[model samples]
Target: MTEIETRVLRPDAAGIAEAARLLGAGALVSFPTETVYGLGGDARDSVAVARIFDAKGRPHFNPLIVHVPDLDAARRFADISGPVEALAKHFWPGPLTLVAPLAEGHGLSPLVTAGLDTVALRVPAHPAAQDVLRVFDGPVAAPSANPSGRISPTTAAHVLAGLAGKVDAVLDAGPCPVGLESTIVGGTPLALLRPGGLAQEDIERVVGPLKTAGDTITAPGQLASHYAPNAAIRLNANAAHPGEVLLGFGPMQSDLNLSVTGDLIEAAAHLFDHLHTLDAMDRPIAVAPIPNCGLGRAINDRLRRAAAPRT
Candidate 1:
């Protein structure tokens, strides 16, 4: 494992140049995307893409999502048809990932797609990420910057905690704004591959209703025992359980309630960070069930996946 060095990028020439150089050299760099801190590398380089998998111990079968500068860049990676174009036009530069069939002549390495016929791509809305992308001439393939099946990183420190000695550099762009993964929609009739910062209703509003895939997954962010903390997260409600570290929504911190006052968005932002904290304490954890709507749906999905049986 290589020690990962993180630099707070100055808003000047030197910082951007350094970042571009590291990325161009096939080194892994963690950067802020609107959705979360993504462990990024040149999308066209299979060696760099494979390093992302090796560093995180990610399974080869779970595909990575490519982060592009804009819709035009995305077109170079995947074949965007009418509906896909429409959705990108309206909701892109935000937290939406479209899984379109990879163009036969696409330039992105097959490893980024996990040898699949399709690829997941997004153009983030974060200004910091946009600046970084603009400085670089190519798209980047990045997954959540954490170890495979563990909690994803929303802050640069979180990336350091998990991958400090495993990667080359981390561009400290600060905390992620949306603080979750992008919603992945794929295939005919357009199914939800992963619930994320973007809500289902919002996607449906622009692209029509989406067919939802099952909880089990074969790609990034889809594992049953994923997004887990070292501490056991038991899914309970406001109801208390003995010897359990409980997470409550706004004001509900009976024993670390995650915003016990019931602000779903707050809970969403704090979810992984809190889990990592508690897991560090090595205590047993229980999470109160939240309403399965809007961000709640993404929240609950993460909790369910976290509690999935770990072999």
Candidate 2:
């Protein structure tokens, strides 16, 4: 594992300045987002962005999202049209991502775009993230702060566990409230690039209906096999397969049941953490199919990817 300098940040000017300095120096800074901790760097710095891909072993073909201080700053990377602008105004500072054409002279590094014309942008609601971006002058190219093809980090420990020696710093902001990736909406007719902390219906209510992308999605988190753990995962009720371990959502249990709460929020909160634990259990894993609604949709999306036939 690559060794990285890790620092804990408090909500103070000193902490913000330290984080800004690390980013300015082209080092990867993993910080809290309302959705998940993000492994980020200066979006305009090709060298810095390359460091992120190298740190996470993230594929060059898969794009990254730009985290801005606010909607105004977000507009710098992408041209915000009427509908995109409306959604950003209403749902930004929350778990919503808008993909739009890059603005002229946006100066975003090509590595961040993976050669795509569009850029994925979001204004996270996490206070630590907001403050860091606010004090910093440049855009942060961030993806979920974890190893590529693994479960995303929802808490600082998750970052420390997977990225402790892989990045420069980590801003612990307690357990992520949303505990999932942001809802990415883009493409023609405005589709859901990835299901996440936000629901598809909530997005439609504000921006009208959205088209859900197919299995081979172009945006981040759309790959058929992603957000996986070390151990094999079986989705639906397929835990009974020989040698398979289990992660049940409600009453079911093959190895560990998330809970009897039957609440998607509760399940989402435990999802990745449980997957991590199951990996530690050193066995095959199985997860109950969560309902396809709200965060459940996002959770199931990850589970499906995890359970897909591994290469």
Candidate 3:
């Protein structure tokens, strides 16, 4: 594919209009969501959707999450009922993606679902994302803006650095607040397809226990060795070994700290940013142990996957 110059669109009326126009014309745009930056394309356009996979080097088997303006918009494509309905009522317009059966005559490109019977839909809470979706006025199939199986981008700079010429443009609205990806839940009796910005315990209180997703790649973000850095990673470390940089969780001195107070919310927001910072330093990563409770589960999940053996 020939490289095209990527435009950095400001967060303004002009930017939103341009973004919507570009998507309507079947072009890929990278914009910020609360969880992370999302590489977006008009979901109904097969060519645009396929370009997303090509740009990110994403496997066709792994699905993409369709971002909509609101829950009502999402209902146009997916049968959000039962557990999906219950979860959507509580978590709509937040960091949650619900997998549900496709609604009849849903116009999404088959590539968005990777040929699955269900589709992953999210009503992102980011104001910029909301504005783009509202003005664009259609479902957008988006995944993390960074290259596939690499660190997810949390800022406009990260997006530019990783995907500069591949996309049509980036809607720059500054850094993402909820730095982790949205928590994904679906399936019979409700299941946690992927742990994320929302805590598991918080969801359990509303929907009782959730079944854990198995090794089967039923959802996006389920790849075994993903969100990886170029350097090797060692988890559960108290300090860095020689030639390694330490990523600290709680109050401790190191190359960088996720949270000085050990707050999971703060840590979750810092996870990707810190990894990006440290990864650029050209050394291995030694991560300080993160508690496996609450949002830490999502942090650890990313770390484990980042540290996983590459294929």
How many clashes in each candidate? 14, 4, 0
Ranking by lDDT: 3, 2, 1
Q: Report the lDDT tens digits of candidate 1 across residue range 26-122.
A: 9888888877888989999999999999998998888898888899988887899878888899988999888898877888888888878888889
Cα deviation at 97, candidate 3, in Å, is 0.5
**Candidate 3: clashing residue pairs, number:** 0
lDDT, residue 42, model 3? 97
Given candidate 1, what's the lDDT at residue 90?
90
Q: Candidate 3 on 1-311: residue-level lDDT in tens?
A: 76989999998999999999999999999999999999999999999999999999999999999999988998999998886888899988999999999999999999999999999999999999999999999999999999999999999999999999899999999999999999999888689999998889988998899998988877899999999999999999987899999999777989999999999999999999999999999999999999999998999999999999986
RMSD values for the candidates in order, in angstroms, are 1.9, 1.9, 0.7
Candidate 1 minimal-lDDT segment of 10 residues: 3-12
- Full-model lDDT, candidate 2: 0.84
Q: TM-score of model 1 relative to the true fold?
A: 0.94
Worst 10 residues of 2 by lDDT: 250-259
Q: Which stretches of candidate 2 lie over 4 Å from their true place?
A: 214-217, 238-244, 252-255
TM-score of each: 0.94, 0.94, 0.99
- What is the lDDT of every predicted structure here? 0.82, 0.84, 0.94
Residue 78 displacement (Å), model 2: 1.1
